[model samples]
Target: MGKASTVTSWLCCPCRCLFCGVLSCFLSVLACVLLTAGLVVLVLYLLFRPHIIHATAVSADLTNFTLTPRTWILRYNLSLALQLRNPNKRIAIHYHDVAAEAYYEGQRFAHADLPDFFQDTGESSPLNTAFLGHGSLVGGVAAAGFRREAAEGARFSIDVKLGAHMKLKLWVFRVPGPKPKIDCPLRLKRRNATAGAAGPPPEFRPTECRVWF
Candidate 1:
């Protein structure tokens, strides 16, 4: 019985050691794989740190504008010129579902839809959208403000907001990325009817606009 007990102990010890050895090998391989993945991510981030995508409102034209004093009805037609630029040397940007809105003193008066397009690395694309606001009623305060600006020869301000979904294309791999939100505050100089001269189109200074993800 003693000899049988000793033989059983020796057999169990070898089996336990073999099991432990296999588990250790698997754990080591998993750690190595995790480390490799982390390093790859770090490298990618470093390589793409300097490149940025930007959107700007380059110019705008207020073709027609009219206001009825009796009914406080406003009508206007405007066109906006937009530019999208990708400054990355190796990364391209794909933009989708672009939309824009124009607001006058927190009141939305116009909306525009832009086409989906892609911009290559170090390239820019131009976009033009026309906005029409026909027979829109305005509040008394808004009408008063417009009149005051016109009388004083002050610029009228309009806020334009843009939103779009974007993706990054690096060679054959297309990675999902963050969307962009852009705000362009435009100032329009009222046309001078007394001078019998048509004013120039509204100008947008890119440096004054804000762009973010």
Candidate 2:
């Protein structure tokens, strides 16, 4: 019985050793694969040399803007011209989706979806957006502020923002990249935008947008 036990133990020992060897080889190969993948990523990053994108507010036209305090309604017809710039000379970018919004006093009042397009390396394109709808103000405070601004017909300040999902490409390889967020503060006032005024000569100075990923 002791000799039989000894033979069984020896056979089991070889099986255990074989498993350990296979596991060690697999782990070694996995480590090599991971290391290679990391190095490739690093090299690609260096090669692309991507830079920050810029979106500048080139111009704007505000034809009609009115607010009714009792009804909490805001009506605006505003058009904007924004220039989108890609500073990277080697990395092309594709914008899959983009949305533009207009805000007043920290509240979103209107929005529009822009068309999706691709930007070649170091390209610049002009994008136009229009907000021509009315929205209900949610709070009394916002309504009061709108009324106050309308009373004097002074310059109206609107916060415009753009959000998008984009990808970067080099040669035939494409990598999912960071989404860009662009924020621009617009100040527009017609020369005679008094109470109940309608249209024309609204000045929208060119403004630089703050951008982030």
Candidate 3:
């Protein structure tokens, strides 16, 4: 009877050890699963998240358009006032650089900045120099690509002040939360604009302006 009892105790010890090992492994797996699930939930929330409606392109107008000779040899200064209407509840619109492009006779002639009346919040960043034209004064005719003399019968093409390849980036954030990036493209046209003598605006209009959701 003594030998039988010792054998029974040994068997029970091994069984308990095996059960403990299995329990530890199960708990570890459970923790890993919970961590993975949390990550997945966070990703899904970010992907489908809706952002605050800030500034939008309500209407764009160009006024006080003027051109004058620049001190630089053959260059001319092109200055124009840009007025943007934002129906969204935001106070100001942020542009990387907003400016106007002047196309004459189907060819790009000069680029100018949107009026500096629009203020930028960040000082470290360059003032939203919308066009190739620098702030304060923008040299027009003498720009690198165009000649000093205006084309005899050039038609004007007006586009938004951003650079040719540059686009607008809308930042979405609930302060203290991770900020997400949304890219919005602009659609600008010369409105109520008249052409020189007998010219119709060129056919190179943007197909559609992109808006973020």
The global Cα lDDT (0 to 1) of model 2 is 0.86
Please name the candidate that would achieve the greatest lDDT relative to the true structure.
2
What local lDDT score does residue 110 receive in model 1, on the 0 to 100 scale?
Answer: 82
C-alpha lDDT score of every prediction, in listed order = 0.77, 0.86, 0.38
- RMSD, model 3, all Cα superposed? 12.9
lDDT of 2 by residue, 1-213 (tens): 999999999989989999999999999999999999999989977987778998999998777777875887888888899999999989899997899999998999999999999999999989899999898878888877776776666567789999999888888888898999999998876345463345455656789999998
Question: Residue 210 lDDT in model 2?
Answer: 97
* Residue 82 of model 3, lDDT score: 26
How does each model score on TM-score? 0.71, 0.76, 0.28
Higher-lDDT candidate of 1 and 2: 2
Q: Rank the candidates by TM-score, best first.
A: 2, 1, 3
Which pairs clash in model 1?
none
lDDT of 1 by residue, 82-192 (tens): 787778888888989999888776778888889999988899888677888775546777887777766765467778888889888888899887878888888766454
**Model 3 lDDT, residue 135, Cα:** 26
